[model samples]
Target: MATTTKDRLIEATAELFRHQGYSATGVKEIVDAARAPFGSMYHFFPGGKEELGAATIRWSGAMYGELIEIFYADTSDPVAATRQFFEAAADTVRDTDYTDACPIATVALEVASTSDPLRRATADVFESWLVQLDAHFARNGLTKTQARSLSVSLFCLLEGAFLLARATREHRHIRAAGRTAAAAVRDALEHRASTVARRR
Candidate 1:
């Protein structure tokens, strides 16, 4: 299928944002990377860079969340699924020379205080991820609140691990963080099971 110009622009902006950040990536760079016409950016996004940035955030976020769903879909055990997801992420970082991680993290941090629209875009993306993770945990025997809290914790672990791993150029941080997240999920599932048994 032929990719549309707008899609290419969004993808290019996302890639730039992943490697650099919102402030560092220019419209020209995006168009060049995307092989898109210069004026197409404004034509598709009248609000200019800010609008494009927000759209890129949402687009990248959805793509990442869908990836999580695909990774977890085949594995019924939530703990195993969690470990697999983190391990895969670590491998990807190492393979890509640490150039790839969460596509929105860089932009999210850069725009958190400076731009309201971008901040909201990041928040919405994070919330969507949390919702997906929460659903997976709940399906695996966790209470709604427990699932949501664990999802948040796991996300924090992954994001922080990505930063640490990239800085050190080592995979140990990713492995360690994955272990901790997997342990947390395991404990939650066990605790829920025990509680149910105790009530019976």
Candidate 2:
């Protein structure tokens, strides 16, 4: 299947947004990277950069969500799976010279305060990823509330670690975050187990 100009533009923009920030990235750069004609951008995105940015965020979020699901489905322990996910993420950041962090983190922080549409789009993506993690926790025997809170904590740790790791070019922070996240998940699961035992 031939990729459309719009697809190319989104792919390129998402990559740029991950490296640079949303405000720092330009439409020309995106089209140039995509190797698409300049006018095709406006034709595909009449609303211009903002529209394209939102689409890119959503696209990146959906792709990351699928990756998360794959890890959980393939692993026997969801908590360990989550740990391995962060470990892999930290390793990628190190291997890529600290340039390969979350696709949406930099853009999300930059646009969250300025672009209402883009902010909401990023927020939705973040929430969706959390929900994906939460679903994995729930499937592993956590109650809805427990799973949701644990997921939130895990994601916050990841985001925070990404910020620290990128700035420091060190995986220690992310590795620590992974440890904390794993403990949080394990604690939640243990608490749930105890509660269930008491009920039984």
lDDT of 1 by residue, 74-155 (tens): 6789888899999999999999999898899988898999999999999999999999998888888888999999999999
Which 10 consecutive positions of candidate 2 have the poorest summed lDDT? 70-79
What is the C-alpha lDDT profile of model 2 across 1-200, one tens digit per residue? Answer: 59988899999999899899888898889999999999999999999999999999999999988988888876658778878989999899999999888899998888878899999999999999988887788888998888889888888899899999999889889999999888887888889899999999
Candidate 2 local Cα displacement, residue 16, angstroms: 0.6
Itemize residue pairs with steric clashes in candidate 2: none
TM-score of 2: 0.96
* Cand. 1 TM to true fold: 0.98
Count of clashing pairs, candidate 1: 0
* For model 1, the run of ten residues with the poorest summed lDDT: 71-80
Each candidate: RMSD to true structure? 0.9, 1.2
Best by lDDT: 1
Query: Model 1 segments beyond 4 Å from truth?
Result: none
